[model samples]
Target chain A: MAQKNKLQFIILGLLNQQPLTGYDLTKAFDTEIGEFWQAQHSQIYPQLKRLEEQGYITHEITISGEKLEKKLYHITAIGQTLLGSWISDGTPDLTATKDEFILKLYFIQTNRDPRLKAMVQEQLQLHTDKLTHLQQRLATVFPTKASQTANYGHYLILQHALGREDYYVNWLNQTLSALPKR
Target chain B: MAQKNKLQFIILGLLNQQPLTGYDLTKAFDTEIGEFWQAQHSQIYPQLKRLEEQGYITHEITISGEKLEKKLYHITAIGQTLLGSWISDGTPDLTATKDEFILKLYFIQTNRDPRLKAMVQEQLQLHTDKLTHLQQRLATVFPTKASQTANYGHYLILQHALGREDYYVNWLNQTLSALPKR
Candidate 1:
């Protein structure tokens, strides 16, 4: 299947939670699933339309403004079945990481200028900021005491994000200290 | 600049060490840089052709078989200068991870079938195998006594790879234990 179909399943999964318009879906991606999965407004709208056409989703038109029409999509029973099957059948491909940061690190020896240290510092700060934000979300979004099966996935994902951010910070620190002093 | 340009610089950087054909470059990516940077032959060959046209790189054609000619690319002085400038000027983008595994984990709750545990185990085993390969490379590719600046970069990159695999293992273990018994 085309990789775009994953986006379709993600949208269906999100709609299974609650009805959301295209704009709302964008916000949902930015605030919630944005950490790992992202789709542009262009991609989202088209996928939403396709899902509706396929009977996996149906939207209600609402009047948000005098001339604007808002589409609030809700998942159909078929959508739920599709999402379940997709989740069970799909496997994540373990291949190369196309991460630019890691790529930059590989080539760092080519230019050992002092500015490189500053750049590493900036990256460290970015990871630190992300770590703080994720910790906050963990506390508020999925409290430790909540043992609901639905929250289990979020809990595990949050842990992974935190682990990744911490790993970046560790690497940046090690790299900075290992760099030759100017 | 387009992201493809990054691949161009990467190829030039690799060729700075020694001359290589497109096949060698692909192998280099799969072994040395595969953990962080990856480019298929389709992308590599076109970029190499473009670099040759730009005079940043040149290729010498050699007869490989009765019916085939192989081109081995070598970096020019201009190519080295270009690579150095690109490395100094470029900064890695700090953004969301487009990791498909994390994306799958995010929605794993949608299908809480018992098989999900086995899937996580499979992922863990893959990571473990990768970690083992990276560790072996660390010993063979960059010995501890090698203090060359170039070796330093490879050493660090390998560390990052090992760190990432270890992180995956940790996350998978935590997730598995946290999951309710089937």
Candidate 2:
């Protein structure tokens, strides 16, 4: 059998932690994994079904509160094994950065359009917003980094995001100022 | 009509500078854009064919020697227009970070395997190697920062990459030290 994609494994990882319906999985991805990973609801539902079909996960249908039916899925032992193997697998390709923003920024110097200034401003705000959200999440999730042993990876990643955003904001400011005078 | 993917425009941007064969384009990407953008020869060839079919680029078969003919592709006016618009376009989604290492590192805390230290070490070497490459490229290409006005974007992006790899190396070292004694 072909190896599952990262999204499938990400779903498996989430379900490995706790039983969650498709809705709950989507929400968890938004709040928890949104920093380093993100997926749309459309993408999640299909993967959840595929995992169930492949015996990596199982779901139970339950009716709650008058016609509200939910399929709560949890990882199977097989899924746990898969997740464990994936986690311990010693390869991570770090060279790939498929970021469109970087590409745009790289070429922006060649672009003479006046609107480029506004674009840079907008990007600054976006990074600012993301940094703020990351700070809020870090504060809420790990009130004190002392008790963060089990979730040390998450704590460190949050710090990394903060540093990265700061770097981008500073770069964006420099780029804005470097734009040719109108 | 569907918007052309970023690779097509990236190709256009390169050819806009000067005509290049498929092989030459691949090498340019590897040496020049490889740090921020990367595409294999297989991907580049297909995209070149597609761009030719789409009329965004044109290729000329030229004979250089006996039994050696190369197809050199150049960006057309339409391609120039497309590239210009893409550069000036205002929207850039920054939430996405497709770094596999980040995902792997995110889940590493749960992995109890002793090999995790080796993995972190490997990552450090990779980043160090990349940093060395970037620095060399900067020195050779720029010579002096004052003469880099035409390539300011490239200069800035190189700095960004240096900062990023440094960040990664530091994080990897911290991770290595934090790994449970084995």
Candidate 3:
């Protein structure tokens, strides 16, 4: 079996929500969609071309600010079906994420690695800021039960992201305390 | 700037722990290391060759059985220094992981997507199992602070893994409960 092109489906999902220009598609990878999956312009642009060629998506030239042309891509019905099937399908592999920090930590061997305290502090600051940011998003994005129901899946995703950050923040705090005082 | 071949460093770390045959190295991924990072034989074998060429690693032929021969890999002193520097280096990137399940969830749009209940249930089961596995490992490996100190970094890694699993299991439980009763 051939490998699935995940980026193509991600683009399809976003387009299925609303027609977006190539620029808009690229921005999504740098923002919300980038939270869990990733894509680069080099990868996205080519995938867009392939998706258009496969008859899964089509684009129309739309004018921006002052007659600048942009290709706003729309998902064809075939694309919708493909995306629907994909969303409904099962995720067979739930492998571990490639976390470089954890991998580095594994090589510590002892608590006296000299750089260990600084390393842990850096991660603590990073995850602490992330937790605050996620908390703000939850407040702004949902705010109420009705707002949450308005985009149930998105709400769940934000909730999950917040949960992940919460775990990291808690872990970092614990790891920091366990380290010797400066 | 160039991207680091993380697999090479990971191989060096394992060899630094003990001289192991290629097969033993491969099994580590399937067991402990698989919890965070992954590498396939196709990738691992070639990378080992390169590491040997770079003088970061070397191998000796040893008999595993009556006539079975295997190459036991060991890290060079230079390799140990490389691993030490890498572990000490600051991790600049903390980008979001590529979690396909979360990406698929973002498309759900509504809780009544027919498959939503089953989909969430599947994950709940997987994560629940993972939590149990991690918990068991913690009990067996640590048992006491003395035992944990034997491999302090490994203990911390296991702790982080458990925390991650705990968060996932909790989220999955909440999601399952939120779904419409069938």
Candidate 4:
């Protein structure tokens, strides 16, 4: 895979923490990993099926009346083994594929609408808000936890996100101000 | 587009600086934007074609005897206008996506291989190397030219890339050391 099949590993990693349905997995992604990792139901569902077929996971189909049903996935011993192998063997390249900020900046000079500038400003604010929330969550999750080492790792990633967002907000302000008035 | 066609704009952006052939454009991406942006010819050629079809760029084909030919692209007036609009419009939601380092760390407890630890160490070194290069490039590119303001915008993007890389390196080192020795 051009990208590591980390989605499966992510699912395994989360399930290793606790059992979850596909729906629950999606929610976890949004709540816990949304900032640094993103997945759509489209990508998640297929991977879930693949994991089951490969015997790394087994699913229980729960029927809650005619109108409600869900498949909950639990890791198998083989799944744990596979996930362990991946964790040990997977050398995820640190390289990121694309960034929207640089993309927009590349073409910013082409835009004619003042609203475009405002949109960038809005994005900066959104990122700042997210960074704030991530930091708060980190504090809540790690407060007095014995895993000081893991907490430090989490803090590093959060700090990077925070730093990058701050850079964007600063750049947006300067770029907007420097643009010739429409 | 799910992803903004940044590659197209990147081509237009560089052509705005000066017309360049496909090989030259690839080289520029590697040298100038490699820290924050990347494109293989597989991506660039198709985007160039699309840009030409959209009247954002025009190309001249030059033949260098048998099996050797090149197409040079220059931004059209409309291309310049479009690029400007994209810039002013800011970018699409600057949603940060998956970080491989975090994914690897999350699964690190599963693996027991010494090589896995070594792999993370290698990645830490690579990220450090990249961060150093990005810092040097930023110092060279910014606050020196008449276009220093514009250059600063690009520098901010590069800074984000560097900051994120630094974060990954820190995380990798901490996580690797924290792992139980085999």
Candidate 5:
């Protein structure tokens, strides 16, 4: 993996927490981590090989069931140091945001477009459902104050996700209200 | 242009408002539209060629600086109909968000990590500056209720941008306070 590919470090960080198989890493990208970053199995498998070649990680062969062999990947000591440096590094300016819904909305020209009401209604429901899902994850992931404080950085991430969804839902609701009731 | 590349519609939307040279179209991506969508000159120029080939947009030759020729593109009648249908179409589920900062923050094992303070401080300043910029544009672009109502969808987009920055700034501030001071 190139130094600029943040996914390598994201994988490293996950392995820093605990050993995981390539399959486990792929699943993480599909779920919670998918909320902020994305990776395909195609990208993950190759990246894992490179990470091991670079000596940042290693894998142990194990049998899952009858004859299925799996490699449980673990971060090395140097890998932990690199992950810390990456987490602490200054972020680049101008984060890219590719919200196609907002881009499509830019062309609507007028609020009175006949499709505006349904468009806004669809988004409102989606954002509301998303907010509920994030809230549920927060409750289940860190059920008590002690649990939350123990995983303080993770707790903060969940808070930020909740804030993002809450803000999005409110914005959609206001937008829906502003449309003419035709 | 493929039916799936939304940049074509965005270029059409900008041209539908007024004719523009390729440079002007490129500038729009670098500015206002860059807030949510992005494209490089390489991407924009090739897409413009494909769009013309597809007969969705047409251009007229214009001279600038006494000797330089430029193609001022205009959306064709077919383009307008297509843009309308596209804006009216249902957006895909799960808009992608690739927030690298938030992803990196996930690896930060504790709030007490020494770099946490600087990281939050840097983000707070960036978000604050962004909020001020959005507010200024909103005031300048739609200074009157009459103008705002005239372009209601665009006005609503500005409001949403402000709300997004407002929430991000507040979250950064809260995160800053959560850190244990050295």
Candidate 6:
């Protein structure tokens, strides 16, 4: 199966923590996993529907009285069992896909356009902002719960993001010095 | 447009240098751009077909006597314009989607199984080997042609790959050190 299918298990894993409305799921992903993992509403809503169809989760119509009715989903026992199995089993051995930043840099040497250098600099700034935001968020979440087993996974992800951003900032500085003047 | 669409432009950018078969494109990607960019036969063949339909490339069928026929594609003028515009005006956004390795690590932390740690270690070794092979191939390709203008972009890609591999190795070491004893 395409690793995309693993998103199903990830959703199940999250719902295993608490029953959630679709909006609640989106909020959870943004706060918890969105630092490293992102999903579009287009991808999430369809997956939720499929999971409900497969009996992995059940949804209840929630009448909010103020807005449109919402569907809240809770993981079924089968869903928990499947998620447990997926967690225990190894992940698939798929190669990482191509990254465009590297590709643009590849063409930069040949092209030697000043715009390319600006692009790289822009990316560096964006990453720096994101990394800082993530660090702050992680600190807020982990101050008291730092040693909790559940929070450990998120801690590692934040660490990875921090490391990557530091690397990029250094690289961008070096690249700027090396770039030929327009 | 999905950044995957950019793969076609990358292919066209390379083909602008010389006409090549699908196999040649794959080899170029593996040796030169594989560090930050990757695509399988499943993706390439379909993209090539689409490019042909769009009149951006023309293919010539070569009969190799007893061997299988090869289709060598050459970028047309329209393709060159498209590629040039993509490189010049393309947004250098470095958006990356989900990563399975990180996802698996998240699951592993929850399970805390020794076998899982061992499995991650093994995967890390394989990635290291591949990175080493790619670096060697890049050295061979750019030995005397190092300072060529067009080779600059290629050099940047190699640098990204090396940096990424270093990050992965470091992560593996930290993970191993942090692993709880069985």
Which candidate number has the best DockQ?
3
Candidate 1 global lDDT: 0.78
Model 6, A129-181: lDDT tens digits are: 87788678667766664454565665676677768777777777777777777
Residue B140, model 4: lDDT of 78
Of the pair 2 and 3, which is ahead by TM-score?
3
Residue range B56-135, candidate 1, lDDT tens digits: 99999898769698999999999999987776664546656666666666766633657678778878887888788888
Model 1 clash pairs are none
DockQ (Cα-based) per candidate? 0.53, 0.47, 0.74, 0.33, 0.70, 0.49
Expressed as tens digits, the lDDT of each residue in B79-136 for candidate 2 is 8998888877766576467655566666645435565676678778988887788778
Question: In order, what lDDT does every prediction score?
Answer: 0.78, 0.77, 0.86, 0.70, 0.84, 0.73
Q: List the residue pairs that clash in candidate 5.
A: none
Determine the C-alpha RMSD for candidate 6 after optimal superposition of all C-alphas. 3.3
What does DockQ come to for candidate 6? 0.49
Higher-DockQ candidate among 2 and 5? 5
Provide TM-scores for the models. Answer: 0.90, 0.87, 0.94, 0.79, 0.95, 0.84
Candidate 6 residues B106-165, lDDT tens each?
A: 544453655567666776787677668767866676666545456777766666666767
lDDT of 5 by residue, B51-81 (tens): 9998999989988899999998999999889
| Model 1 ranges with Cα > 4 A deviation | A1-4, A65-67, A90-92, A110-116, A147-150, B1-4, B65-67, B90-92, B110-115, B147-150
Over 4 Å off, model 6: A1-4, A29-31, A65-68, A92-94, A109-115, A144-150, B1-4, B26-31, B40-46, B60-63, B66-69, B90-92, B107-116, B143-150
User: Just chain B of model 6: what TM-score?
Assistant: 0.75
Cα lDDT tens digits for candidate 1, A77-156: 99999987776764647757666656666665633656677777877887888889998888787764545356566667
lDDT of 3 by residue, A15-51 (tens): 9999998889889877677778776788888889999
Interface RMSD of candidate number 3: 1.1
Binned by DockQ into CAPRI classes (incorrect, acceptable, medium, high), candidate 1 is medium
Q: Which model is ahead, 2 or 3, in terms of lDDT?
A: 3
* TM-score of chain B, candidates 1 onward in order: 0.86, 0.84, 0.93, 0.73, 0.93, 0.75
lDDT of 2 by residue, A48-140 (tens): 988888899999899999999999998999989988888777664665666666666666444355666787798899988888888887788
Residue A57 in candidate 5, Cα distance off native in Å:
1.6
Chain A TM-score for each candidate, in the given order?
0.87, 0.84, 0.93, 0.72, 0.94, 0.82
